[model samples]
Structures are given as C-alpha cells and as structure tokens.
Target: MAAMKKKSVKKKSVNKKTASKSPCKQKLSVSISHDHKLGHDPLAWLSGEEIQSLSKINDTVDPMTFKETKIENEKIHVPGIEAEKNIDQPVALEEMTKDIDDVKASETGSLPGDEDKTQRTNEDDDMLILPEIFGIAQAEDMHGELSSLLAVSGDIEIDASTIETLDASALQLLIAFIKECKSSGRNVIWKKSSAKIDSAASLLNIGTLLEL
Candidate 1:
C-alpha cells in the first residue's frame, strides 16, 4: 500500500507539470481594436497588385487563424509604442494609378456607359452612370448600400425614394449588378446613405447617357 501511494503521488505531479508546460501557453498580452468591414467585394476596393499581394499574404497567414479570430479581433498590438504606426501601404500608389487611368480615359473620351464583358446588364451595351465625386471616399456609400441590399430584401428601386421599395429580389439583383460591374473594371458611384441617390438617378442625363 505504501509503494502504491508513492507511485500515485508521482503520477499526479508529472501530470501537473505536463499541463503547465502546454504548447498553448502564452506569456505576453497585446491587442488592437478594429471596426472591421467583412464580406467586402475585395475586387472593387483592392487593386490588381494589392489583391495579388493580399492573396500571397492569405496563403502565408494560416487559414486557421482567420477562422479562429474575427477580422476585428485579428489586429495585432506591438509592445513599446514610442510612435503610432499607420497603414503599411501608402494611399499614393492606388491614387496615382487611378489618376493615370482617368487621364487616359479623358484622352480617349471614355463615356460612363462603356461596356465590358463581365457587366450584368441583359443588354450588351448597358453603361454605368459615373458621378462627380471621385476617389475611395465615395466607395463607402456605394459598398454599404450594396452590402445592405445583399443582406435582405426590401423595395429595391433606383428611384428618388427607392429604399422603401426594396425587397429581397431587388437587393439580390442590385448586389449582382455591383459585383458584375466590379469584376468588369467598370467605374462606380457609391452614393451617400442620405444623399438621395434616387433623386440623382432622376437628375442624371439618361438621354445623353444612352448610346444610340
């Protein structure tokens, strides 16, 4: 009985040591808060290079990490914050590329209604109406409505009072249109939430936009 008790005590100590030495042991603590945007149409927001870079990063960033952590929770906080670090990639490159494209488009007088193969219109020649405000700032409004429409059905009208008319079908169609346009490299105007896009749609020179 004495020998058995000694062996039992030894086994308990070994188990405790093994538990304490678990590979999952973490010592340091740091975190960051992010108001994450999920289900983003990455193609719309990311340049070809950025997309490629992200894909490489994704390949390297263990897929399990993404599954385990929500996008907002994945933000890393480095210790010893002597200075605040900004986004790694500068906005300049994307802005420059967009400017160059706009210049080239101007030189060629590219109309808003330009057709690309991936566009969602049933007709081959359907064109998007380009708005005056340029840059990524406009994209927020555009993607928000686009995302909302995709989420549920409501009265989906391109009218001045359209949101009230949106239904599930309309939202689905709108999402499809946005995706198609994005995939086709078509220019888009993300309207502001309170911007009365339906009114703008009415104001748009539809006659002039239509290609005869």
Candidate 2:
C-alpha cells in the first residue's frame, strides 16, 4: 500500500509540472511590414542618376551677378514751321458736314417730287393732278405732293383722270393718304378716276376703304 501511494503522488507532480511548462512554451507571434514586395526595399528601385536628381532638388543656389550697361540716346531735331507746310491740313468740320450733305442729296435727290411739284399761287386751282403712270415709281412723288397739299390747309381735289397704270402699292399709298386726309378733317375730292384706277381699286378690294 505504501509503494502504491508514493507512485500516485509522483504522477500528480508530473502532471502539474507539464501544465506549467506548456503555458511557458507557447509560440510568440512576430509582426513584419508587407507594404513592399518580399525581399525588395522601395528605396533600392532608384538609380544613381535619380538619387543625384533628388539630392540636387534641395541644393543651395549660387550668388547672381549683374552688369551695368550705359545706353547713349540720340537726340532728334524737328523742323518747326517748315514741317507744318509739308503736312496736309485737316479738313474743317463745316467742310466735312457740307460734303456729307452733298452726298445725301445726290443719293436720295431733293425731297420726293420737289422737281416736278406744281407750283401754284392762291389764285390757281386747288387740285393736285396725278401723273399718267401711277405705280411704285410714282408713289414717292404722289406722297410728297399729297403731303404738300396737306400743309396748305384746305379742301383739295385729286385729278385721277390719267392714271395709265395703277399698281397695288400705289393704290395702298392713295388709300393711306385719303385716310390721313379724313383724320385731319380735310376734304378730299376725286376728280373722276381712270378705268385703270377703278380696276386696281376693285382688285385690291380696298374701294370701300378708299371711299371710292
């Protein structure tokens, strides 16, 4: 019995020693940076020229030298009154304005029918005779003539007896003129229109508007 008890105590001590040794013998974990490839360092990729360029990026600058240069300026001599005679004189504003007015007169001619406007005194008949050909070519003259009549401030008669060719534009101008006459409270008398004028007025369907 004594030998069996001593054997059991030795077995328990062996188990306790084994447990303590197992805790102390546990493997210790080590950490390593894996940012780069296995055996290559990032700085090892740079060549000697590249390292030299990087080193030069922070190198000190050399002292600068500046040389002074003296420039000789040539003096210019200008002629006084003699130079003024050689230069062309500028045109006066009044002359330039006159030239512009002359151009305008040449382009558009004297206002409408002033060239052919019948000059009549108070004793003459108060009638404006239409030209033989009443078309776009004559509308401007007719307008000017009618406007002049309006300025006269009196009841007027329009002689339409000789309108050989009456166009739509001319008819429109006559209709507008008649309207203007009526609005100004002025009387307008039509001295017997030609057959062309009557046909043109009917074709445009403005006979009623013109009070024809």
Candidate 3:
C-alpha cells in the first residue's frame, strides 16, 4: 500500500511538471461533434486582399503599344562654317539644280549678276549652295566632277591612317579645301566611302551646328 502511495505521488509530480509546460507547448482543443465532416470558412480563406496572384503564369499579357517618338533633326556644325544646318536632310531638286548653276558661275569667276545654266543652286537645311549645274551630263563628265572634288578636297589625304601615304600636312590641306567648298554652300562629298570620309570630316571645323 505504501509503494502504491509513492507511485501515485510520483505520477502526480509528473502531471504537475507537464501542466507547467502546457503554456510553452501548443495545446489544441478539438470539439468533435456527431458530424465527421471537415469545417471550412470560405470567407476566411481570403477576401481577395490577403492572397497575392501567382506571377509567371505564362498567360499572355495584353501587348502594350508605346508612343512613337518624334525624330528631331540634328544639325551638324563645322568650324569656320557660318550656316548651322542639318545637311543630311532631303533637299529640293530645283534648288539643287540652281546650286549647280551658281557653282559653275563661281568656278568660272563670273559676276554674280551673270547667271549660268551650267551650274545650279542646291538648298539643304535652309542653306543655299551651288554645284556644277550642267543638265544631265555624260557618265564621264559626272565622274570628272567627282574626281575633281576628290582631288580638290584632298580626300586621299588621311590624317589618322596608319599608312605612310596619309599624313597631317595633306589632311590639313584637304580639310581647308573642304571647308572652303562647304562655305561656298556646295554639298560635295568624298566619293570613296561616305562613312569613312564623314568620320574624318567631323574632325574638321565647319561652324555652329544648326538642328531644325
């Protein structure tokens, strides 16, 4: 009987220790009713605010059309050039013809009042210029003009080239000549490679660049 009492005392002590640990451990109270079905509150699940929609659903999102940006004309400026204009922009055919006429007259050292049909006036970016104004000349004549411009402009002179053929003296002279040609409002360009020539040209002083 005494042993039984001691065993009962030990069990009570263990129960007390377990009761003390009840607050630290998770204790759940389940009210098992006659119904064995699961209880669920659909409203409590998420009122559409608590749950975040799953991203990367691979569902096609509506395509978005961005507004087209307006292309602004960029004016290129060269040192010693008074006209600031966008030279790359399209020019009027009639104006270009007139420019050619004027250029012919200037080359002949004709008086400004004495107009020559052999040259025409070319207008680019609101700037007026003259190119040789002959009406649809032969291929040889056109090639001649191109060659003349190349020779006069000294395009063969490459300042930045690694080859010995191109040097600073010749490039400077070419730059000076091209600068004069552009100042005359003549839209002559290097014939070999437009890109290569333009890259070297940008190094020259034309004038203040005007962007329309």
Candidate 4:
C-alpha cells in the first residue's frame, strides 16, 4: 500500500512537470493614435514663416486654375513655335526672285503680263465699261475680253467708275492688260476711276503697276 501511494505521488509530480513544459497560447493587440494634441503638430519641424508661405502657396494655387493656365500657355506657345517652324523655310530666295523680276520688268518697260504684246491692229479706239463686282469669279471672262482688246489699235478707254467690289484677282487682270497695252505702245485711258480700285491697288502695293 505504501509503494502504491509512492507511485501515485510520482505520477502527480510528472503530471505537474509536463503541464509546466507545455507551450502557452497568447493574443496580441495593436493601437494607432490619430489625435493632433497641442504641442504635437506634424509640421512642428517647419518654421512659422515657412508654414505661412506654404499656406499662401496652397491657397493661391488652385488645381483647376493651374491646369487652365497651363493649357492657355501651351495654346499661346504652340502658334509661336509653329510660326518659327514655318519661318525656317527658304522664303528669302522666293522673295529675292520676285524682287528681281519686278526690277527687271520695271527697267525694261515690258512688265509681266498674261501674253506677249505681239498682235497689233489698226482699228479705231475702243471704250470698255467695267462690271460692278469684278473679282476672282469674273477673272476668266475678264482675261478673255482683255486679251481680245489687246489687238485693238489706238488708245483704249476703260471706265472704272462702275466697279464696286474689286479684289486682288481683278486687279491682277487689269495690271496684265495695262502692261500689255504699254508694251505694245497702245495708250490706255481711265475715263473714270472708282474708290474701290484705287484702295485695292494701294493696299496691294500695285498702284504703280496698275498706273492708278
């Protein structure tokens, strides 16, 4: 019986040791603080003036307005960039050639026209009444009439008082006709002049060319 009691005590002691050696399970918890208490400012490292400047910048720079301003600046800059690109072409050569042609035409007294003034006639002097609206639309008909008239003899009378809407194309045709007349030694008299013709000629810097 004593031996059985000692064995029961030993079993109890082993049970206590096994219980102490077993792993323990525990739960952990984490907490986050979001309160901005006094003397705990996130921007505490920044100076007062720096903070004020930053606030001013934030107030002045609106996201939408800044985006709009950037767009407007791009709009303005794009045209200038395109203009610069266009100006980089060989325009100087074309302009120089045109100037040389004009100078030669002026010096020779045989200005550039549609046709060479070779056809001559001994018919009586003619009078032509210009149409009211002389523009690009009427250029073809006017050119035909002027070419036919170039063959007429004596002084040609041109009544320009009826012209109302005269454009560059009409002015060009008239210039060609006048140059043809001058080269052929035929006189061209402007019986009546219109303000539109004079203004257009002056605007195009072809007043001398048209003998306005």
| TM-scores for every candidate against the unseen true structure | 0.18, 0.42, 0.18, 0.41
Model 2 TM: 0.42
Model 4, position 186, has a per-residue lDDT of: 77
Order the numbered candidates by TM-score, best leading. 2, 4, 3, 1
Candidate with maximal lDDT: 4
lDDT scores of the candidates, listed in order:
0.33, 0.53, 0.32, 0.55
Which is superior by lDDT, 3 or 4?
Answer: 4
Q: After superposition, how far is residue 112 of candidate 4 from its true place, in Å?
A: 37
Q: Can you list the residue pairs that collide in candidate 2?
A: none
Task: Estimate the TM-score for candidate 4.
Answer: 0.41
Candidate 2 lDDT: 0.53
Model 3 Cα lDDT, one tens digit per residue, 1-212: 00011111111111335546784443322222212122232243245332112122222111122222234445655546946553564554664456554564445352222233222122211221222231233233333333334322211222222222323333344445455555655443333233333443465532222100
By lDDT, the better pick of 1 and 3 is 1
Error of 2 at 105 (Å): 12
Stretches off by above 4 angstroms in model 1 are 1-162, 192-212
Summarize candidate 2's per-residue lDDT along 1-212 as a digit string, tens digits.
01111111111112345546894543332222222113222243244232223222222111121122222233333367455334444455664455533553343343221332332222333587877887897677667666656554567787889877778788888888788878877778887767887777787787787677
lDDT of 4 by residue, 50-124 (tens): 322323321222222233211112222246555643332323443455553455344324222213333323332
